[model samples]
Target chain A: MKLLSNSKIWAVAVIMLSGLVYIGSCTRDNDLIVPVKLTQPFAPNRGTNIHLPGTMTVGDPTQWKMDKAHSSVLWSSNYIGTAGLLTGRFNQFGMHDVAAAEMLNYVATGQPLLDNSWAFNEANPAQTFFSGYVQINQSNTGEPGRDGGCNISGMGTTPIVAGTQNLTVTNLAKIKSTKVEFDASSNGYIVTFDLTWQGKLAAPLTKSIVGKLNYITMTTIATATPYKVFGLQLKFQFNCRDFGITSTSIADKIDIECNMNFNNK
Target chain B: MPDSFFAYAEWVELETFFAGYLLVYAIIYLVALNRPATGFVKTRLLPNLPLAYAFAGTLYLGLQLKNAYPDYTIEHLTAGVQLPYLRIWGLISILFWIPLLQKKPVFSLLHSLVFFFLLMKSLFLQLFTSSPGNDMARNNMKIYSISIFLNLGALILVTIISLLIARFNTQKRSTGI
Candidate 1:
């Protein structure tokens, strides 16, 4: 009742309100929020569909190399309180699912490429795995100005890297498969991998997600050489708050759908 | 948003709502411009102190919002909109305090122009540029148009408020009320 009588309290309230704005700008990265575990096996969805130019093949996963020229990694996240979805693509990425060194060593010895000589056995689906990394700085959300947030760590922005601070932290987003097995329900291979994200204020956070993998055959237009392409489509949702990103404009639930194509060189 | 006060109010709807809100404030400011101050806060130091703090607070808040889009924060006028804290415009903000302390209507109007420029300069840069991503995300509502409209509308209200505040102080001294 005496609030209006005291100007000092009103002034202090005004100052404190302004202080809250500054606090809102800083990302919360100290305490990690537990991520929802993925118990269900991956199934084929519209996002993961691979329109093969040729036909399906029973190829060895170990022999496949990443076709960087044709493969792409796209990320999409829903905007908070709106039907809008923020979509972007990472320009620079490397898929090292198949061991190139061992494949090259076999070729250098004038020996035919065989599954037995490879690092992992082709007969066992569990041994078949994939590992890749994405350059955070290279994220292009179509808008060059919006891509600045990608440099901080996650696909979000923080006040720590503004103005004179202009610090560029190379936080490479990485993924490595821990387990791979055949999902008889979907009649496809299911891969469970650790998805790691690094933020400016927090250490790297890892969450396991399941993805669908399909092997398809494609013929190169230049040489007409038939090669096996690894159609690995990973569709999963992650909480942005877990990575210390609290952008009010962007939704906390990030829907990630990656359709990567890897082929033998 | 369904249960919230701003239900169905997306960026476009909010922009439209704020524009009308500022218009109402601008009209109230016009009416207050002719009225004399009856409050005991007549001293320049007493009144100008809060204005100075408000300016700093607004600038800092604007900078943080711009920080949300880092690339646009660089050299405010050239990059995009928000706070150009490090640019020449930031130094110009200091001049706003001079007119407030002096209590001169002429200088106050000039200071209002400076503040208006600071707020509206980014509107031009953002309006002309084309961002495919922004257009798609906003569902063709055109975020640039919304920003330009809000910035212009807000500045109009701010300039009017500045004039009304100057009128109150000057009228209070002249009328001895």
Candidate 2:
């Protein structure tokens, strides 16, 4: 009887002890809080192209030039299509190295960008969407490298700002040899771009646009792209104005100016 | 009895069988604890707590094996594989009945051997056949560390309890009751 009783007591004691030990083991070991270190630094190698859309006026016929005093050419587009949209930008435009490097670092570490999402008003009833990019590369001379791409979606409401209306004929003729120029001044830089666009009316309309010339000017202080972790810093001001468009047409003149800051470290 | 009682009873029975297979280490520990450390063994405790250490080691091996071959038949048996080491106290309860039954040493030893062999087979199956995931392979350091700690602690506890039991048996024998 005594042996049985003693065995029960021992058994219960072991049970209680095991319970305590199991509970202790289940708790996380708080002392080991060492952070993981990166094995090696990743080199940022890719580049990207930045694009800015422009708007033109409707009527008063006259030549317009991209104002280089208050506008700087950061980047441009390439004409990929034949007719519907003759798109291309200045080839010399490219991103600084620091901004490219930093973007690569963020990608390597799997870090999320802070606030990359924005909403804007829709421009045309037929145009369902519009997106933009800020391409970065090693040199502004050779082929540009594409580093990253971001989408601008849900821009639901367009701003009620007015566009130029008195566009003349001289501005329409200068669109053929149009070139975008940037001038670095004491205060800041200015960008001036000229374009000549002409298209016939799709019938039922009398006045066909034989020549449509347009110019855009912008000005801003140079600012580097913001990267939370690492990269090259490229700074540039944001300002854009549109010229050239005649008569009442479906297309409207548009211009935008905003700062773009990025890093490549 | 209520329906819940039957359900719980069924679960307990299933648990017992699963625990029996999973925790063969507990059986080995119980048998080792019950064996007499007589003859040349002058000390009250076994010189090395081999059975307790083996129990902990096998328990850890079982857990690792489960991780490697996660899709094995036993995955559906219980949630989290029900750490076999946790069944140690249950075996300890059964050990309480052993003294009263006065089972032969040969029978107890055979029983222990069978349990040990089953534990070894389960471990081998897991190591050789299971497709261990990337996380298990990468985090081996943490897993091994926990295994070593568990085994060491279990060995110490089992040794102390075995020593106490052996000493108590010796005292009872000497009292001539």
Tens-digit lDDT track for model 1 on A123-216?
3566566666555656678776667653333444332322221112323566777887776776456778887765443566788877766544
Residue range A1-265, candidate 2, lDDT tens digits? 3432224343344334333433433432324346588664544322222212222122211212222222323333222212242222221111121122233222222112221221111121121111112221111323222211110011111111123211122111111111222222211212232222222212111121121111111223344632121111122211111222221211232222222322221
Q: Native contacts recovered by candidate 2, as a share?
A: 0.00
- Tell me the spans in candidate 2 whose CA falls farther than 4 Å from its real position: A1-172, A176-193, A196-241, A244-249, A253-265, B1-138
TM-score of chain B of 1: 0.29
Best by lDDT: 1
Residue A130, model 1: Cα distance from true site in angstroms: 1.2
Error of 2 at A151 (Å): 36
How do all models score by TM-score? Answer: 0.36, 0.25
Candidate 1, residues B63-176, lDDT tens digits: the string is 545655655544653543322332343334345455554344233223333333322333322223442222232322233235334544444545557768899999999999
Docking class of 2: incorrect
Clashing pairs in model 1, backbone N/Cα/C closer than 3 A: none
